[model samples]
Target chain A: MIDHMSALFTLGNMQFLLRGAGMTLLLTMIGCTAGLFGGFLLAYARGSKGTLTAPLRWGATAFVEIFRRIPFLVTLFLVLYTAQMIVPRAPLFWVAVVSICLLCSAYMAEIVRSGMESVPAPQIEAAEVMNFSRWRITWMIVLPQAWKVILPSAVSYMVMFVKDTALASQAGVFELMFAGKALANRGLDPFLVFATVLFAYFVISWPLARFGRWLEAQLARRTHEGDRR
Target chain B: MAHLDISGLEVRYGTVPVLSGIDLAVERGELVGLVGPSGSGKSTLLRALVGLVPPAAGRVVLEGKDVDYASKASLRGLRDHAAIVFQQYNLFQNMSVLDNITVTPVKVRGRPKAEAEAEARALLARVGLAGKERAYPDQLSGGQQQRVAIARALALKPALILLDEVTAALDPELVRDVLDVIKDLAGEGITMLLVSHEMGFIREAAHRVVMMDAGRVVEVGPPSQIFDAPTEERTRAFMSKIIRH
Candidate 1:
């Protein structure tokens, strides 16, 4: 039996994997923050009415569709290879993080657009009639409600977002999966190392999954109470 | 001076005209009830007053200033002059009842938070929501939510207040509480333009009644005159239909 007992005591290799876990968390955090911002711009472009709206909407939609259609690994390759040629001097960490953000932003934009659509037209009309400035209405009214309505789904997406960060290993980003492969190369039992990697993924994903479920229950309760009233 | 003057008003959603060639006016301190069946341009008219609907061709003059030409800065300034309560009770869901009332005052008007919140609390108390200041809109009952909406509008202390079917969404039993608040506002001589289907409230509170049909003012007169002796057959027909039920 491959012993987790032995692996736990292997201090030197464990330190390397722990360091990689730190990198993984950092990549997920940076990628998600950038993705969320880019998604907001995409959603607003899709929502607005103007001559450029059609083209902008099309571009944003296509960007999302293309990334979503391709496998995450392939998208990572395209991002890394193109970026390395364009800006060879930039750090590999940035290249990996930026690629993940670009890929994830498309899905985030769709989620946000759906949330925005769920907001009532009258709420927006109320803001306008009150003569609220565009920025004030968005920040004060629209986005707050949208965020509440979509928060559960967003939490669920974060689990996927974190798992997807593992794909950054393909770009030589030295994340958790990359660390496991390095340990395997040094004659560590491959099954034990990969199992540990799987366990780590479970640890990250499980609490987040439970939190998402709790959020959904809370939202449902509030909506039910709203209807009852 | 007329508080509101709308002339040659035309509104459309794409190619379909919802309201066309509409002209209306309300003098200061007049409580005007805009009565009409659903889709009769009553909501459309209310929306146009504050530039929510872009009128295809019209002039909306408020206090001798053309509202159409007003910039965004001037528009927010005008919000302090006129506040609105929607039928849906479109309160900010994320904010407490007090914050809902105080946001425009503090954020939009640049009033200090403490002072704005103080004004908000007083208005909430006036509307029978004193203890519910910290409750979010979703936490309040529908009637309470609508009252908070009224308090929020009142916090602005505008010269004119537009209420578009404010009690339409409330339970039948809860409707009276909201109407009572409106009655009190009218008694206070606050200039209010109300769009509502509650005939009894209209008769009791409105200084003038303007009945609209097919996007035109079918009749405009004292409530006694319109209710007792409507001039137009269409007005008489509408009254009979509503009163029969």
Candidate 2:
């Protein structure tokens, strides 16, 4: 039984949570930025019509399956603990960052692969006739269209990225969830503190999910209108 | 010299053969139309011509030089001379119409940006899309998009251009606008190989018509002969259906 009252204006607590929220945002932005680039490389390598394509696909698949199967908590524990042994006084924050990036990239790679494949075959043909190199064709043509086509899904992935950052608090990196836990333990009213934390997450993530849905609708409307025209 | 010549061309998708034992030639500045019902290898043949679909067993000679697909350098040399327009307009959808037309010339052809934009603007004007320089593909109509494709192809000043059913996707009313652009392009002396279902355009615009059926050329002659007085039974049957429909 959690009371959803009085925690909003708790000045010291709100500031602490806000600071943690900042760290959470930082973690997601860094992780997703790295994940986007990494995922693209994996997706492109896997999908290319080259001899190395199969091997690269297999390697990426293995990485995804292994990471996705192992519990995130265990993975973080191993990475944080092992990394600390190798280099004491190193930033444990990096371990959390790397873990989130690796997990998100595995999923984002599949999203990007779908985007790449959706580009019409003729588009590449047109590029070839214009004497465009593979690199030029990729950067100048394929990637731009794909970025647009995959945007809604990518935004959803960003939302997932933000939610995933909360898990990093287990690595002792102080973020929103950790901040909430600290506040709850200090106060006698655990339910009030936790309910406020839940509300705070909704405030952050609901907008992202709503924005993604709105974007998807906007794109669909344009496509339907184009067809009608 | 012949602009493009293919001898014993063959293409396959996995174990399924799409084009086999195909032979064709196009002289400089020739306008040739390839017509066939669906799945007649017309598109496959056009793809083969531009090295998009490499032959399983044959040589494509461009200006008397055999296209060696085994060598990247040779293929790059071959690509410089040809441009392709697709059945589905393959405009880079994220870019403005002007960028779609000028990107290859500026980036791939290594022309200065100002020079490429100048040439691209002239091409857009030639295609009657003079004011659509900043419109995105989705903002334009299908006919407009197809014209952008034509302008993009022409921007390269290619020795040979392959148009694969460029108007297949347009509305019936919009079809003529695109074909009219192609007709105007021919008047400018650009060598073009077209695969189209627009029989009227073939009859009026083509200098020569090549009819393909079941992965082979069933007829090759002047459009009048192919359309009005076909000698082959298969050709007559095809024409009869079009006329009846």
Candidate 3:
């Protein structure tokens, strides 16, 4: 029988996997921050009215549709391969991180658009009549209410983002899944290495999943109380 | 010159004309009541005067300045002169009553925060909502919400205020409270153009009554002449139906 702890800890293999886990966490943080910011711009462009913003709205819609239809792995490979042709010596880590952020942004754009749609028309009209500039109305009145509607779903998307970082290994980045595979290839027990990787992922994802549920419960309670009044 | 003058005003939703060749004027400190059946364009006329509904063809001249709807600066200046309270009492659900009353003055007009708050408190008291300053809109009854909406409009200190079926959304018991507040405003000599189905209140409060039918002004006269001695056939028919109902 294979000794699981010995296989995981021997020859600094555990330390290598821990570094990979750290890289995964780092990628998620950077990707989510950039993705969420880009997604907000996309949401505004996609949902804006009038003939002036038509081209921007159309471009945002096309981007979302194209990215959402393509599989994440294919998108990652295409972005990386195209990028390598332009900057042959560019770091694979940045290429993978940028690709992941772009992919996550397309998904988040739809989430944000739906949240914006959930705000009532009269509320926006009220702001307009009060002589608020368009941006002030959107930033202060619309987004505050939209954020409440999107908070739980946005947290869940972050959890999905954490798992998606494993795809960075396909681009030759040394993330958690890549580390486990490399250790197992050295004739170490595959089960022990993969189990450790799984545990590491759960450590990161479990809290996010719980937090999403907690937010949903809190929102539901507030809505219920609002209805009672 | 009239305080508010609308000449050759027109509004359309695509191919359907809502208001056509409408001309009306309100003098300073006069209360003009607009009485019409549903879809007669009374509400659209009020909305157009405030630049809410862009006029298809017309001029709204307020205090000798012809409103230029295409220009943002012109619209801003127009908003300072006029405000509209809708049938739904569109209060900001996210703000407290005090914030709702003070936000435009503090944010748009650059009024001092403490001064705006003090005025808001006084307006609340005038509207009979003295102690409900911190309450959210949902926490108030429909009547109280409408009163708060009136106070919010009053906070802007506009030269003219428009009321478009402001009591239409309230309960029967709640309607009286809102109308009472409007009565108090009429007593203050504020220039008002009120579109209402409350015939009795209109006759009681309005100095002149404007009758509209199918997007056209059919008659304009004192309440006694419009209600008791309407000369136009359409006005007589409209008034008789309303009185019977």
Candidate 4:
């Protein structure tokens, strides 16, 4: 019931979609940066030892578990509605950004915690004998080794986060998916418009995926060379 | 006062005792070698003295002060005065040989990097590892890594050094090179407690040798007396078995 050819390559609709993609890119950047920072703090709290950090450890664990267990769609809707209740004029865009950031941070915390756990106990013990303080050992010895284990998973999460940004369109933000829907509503063929949307996502994610693979390869080669001696 | 002292030292792991009633002393400039059958707690005594193993009972006195192992401040004080080298070398794998040697002095003692690096280079050359400062730990052989670990400990300049079977992990041909370095340290009047299985090296390098069995000291005397004229039945039997091998 529509002309697929005319809808497929229209410049005006393509420009609108590109603008939406730009917003999606901006959201991904802001969300990932904030999420990564929060996740690192959460990871520290979870792994900290001694009686003084006990309450902080418990609170961080509870936060990660609760956020990770809840569905992202439900979290987004809850946050958006809660913000609306507190501030009736709150922008939907900022609401979407905050919700996604909170969700991704929980996942990032687990990724980083596992990486830190993989560092050998003897490495820390050696640092202890050398009279390095607890903080110095964790920051200088533990985290640098952990970062090598954290990077690949972190990049994959970034790709997933970019894809998840499409959900923001549900909150009436004019992101990439929303733009595609707008074009489809103008009597254009729905299949053609969505197929272009799907292709646009591929264009964004493929490079990031490739980059993750390259990083993993580099790490493996480094470890292999270390073993060769 | 003894330079290092352990009296009535007892160590347990979850109700299983590894060391019991261990009393030992080392004077300044003495190299005391600990020889024992496997599971006789020779290494546990070294670990306990270094504050790596918490003692269930007894006191460790260094320079006339008892170390309260349970207190963080006391443990830090003990660590500042003593360092241990493990059987596995335990070098920081993430660092180069130079960084490994210089890290403690620069980071812990707040020494200037230029001074630390210069001293580290001199220590490396002393250990016969000159020109290998930029190499990673894994790039070196077992003997080379152990030598680097010794250099790392020397950079701390602790009052006492504990060598826990430092050459046990090296190849037979490689053992002599590492042993030569420790001999040089001994000749320099460095105070050390060494746990080694090389009977010949023990006879040659140790000023006094302590033989252990079943978590107790069986004999403590000059290496000639312990190896050649043991007073205990267990020491005689252990020596006979070792000689057969």
Full candidate order by lDDT, most accurate first: 4, 3, 2, 1
DockQ ranking, best first: 2, 1, 3, 4
* Per-residue accuracy of model 4 over A18-41 as CA lDDT, tens digit each: 998888888888877888888888
Going through the candidates in order, what is the number of backbone clashes in each?
A: 0, 0, 0, 0
Which ranking of candidates, highest TM-score first? Answer: 3, 4, 2, 1
Which model scores highest in DockQ? 2
**What's the lDDT for all of these models?**
0.81, 0.82, 0.87, 0.87
Better of 2 and 4 by TM-score: 4
Candidate 4 positional error at B239, Å: 4.7
Q: How much DockQ does model 3 earn? A: 0.38
Local accuracy of candidate 1 as per-residue lDDT tens digits, A70-110: 98888888878888799887677888877888876877888
A223: Cα error in model 1, Å:
10
Candidate 1 vs candidate 4: the TM-score winner is: 4
Instruction: Evaluate candidate 1 and give its CAPRI docking class based on DockQ.
Output: acceptable
Q: Report the C-alpha lDDT of model 2 over B184-205, residue by residue, as the tens digit.
A: 8785667889999889899999
Roughly what TM-score does model 1 have, to 2 decimal places? 0.84
Question: Model 2, range A1-229, lDDT digits (tens) per residue?
Answer: 2243464346777899888887888887787777788888777676666564778778877876677678778778888888889988768788888787787777778788788777787777777777777777777777866766677888898887787778888878888888878887776367776776777778778898999999988776674222443
Worst 10 residues of 3 chain A by lDDT: A220-229
lDDT of 3 at B191: 90
What does DockQ give for each predicted structure?
Answer: 0.43, 0.45, 0.38, 0.35
Candidate 1 regions with alpha-carbon error over 4 angstroms: A1-26, A41-70, A89-91, A113-124, A142-146, A176-200, A214-229, B187-189
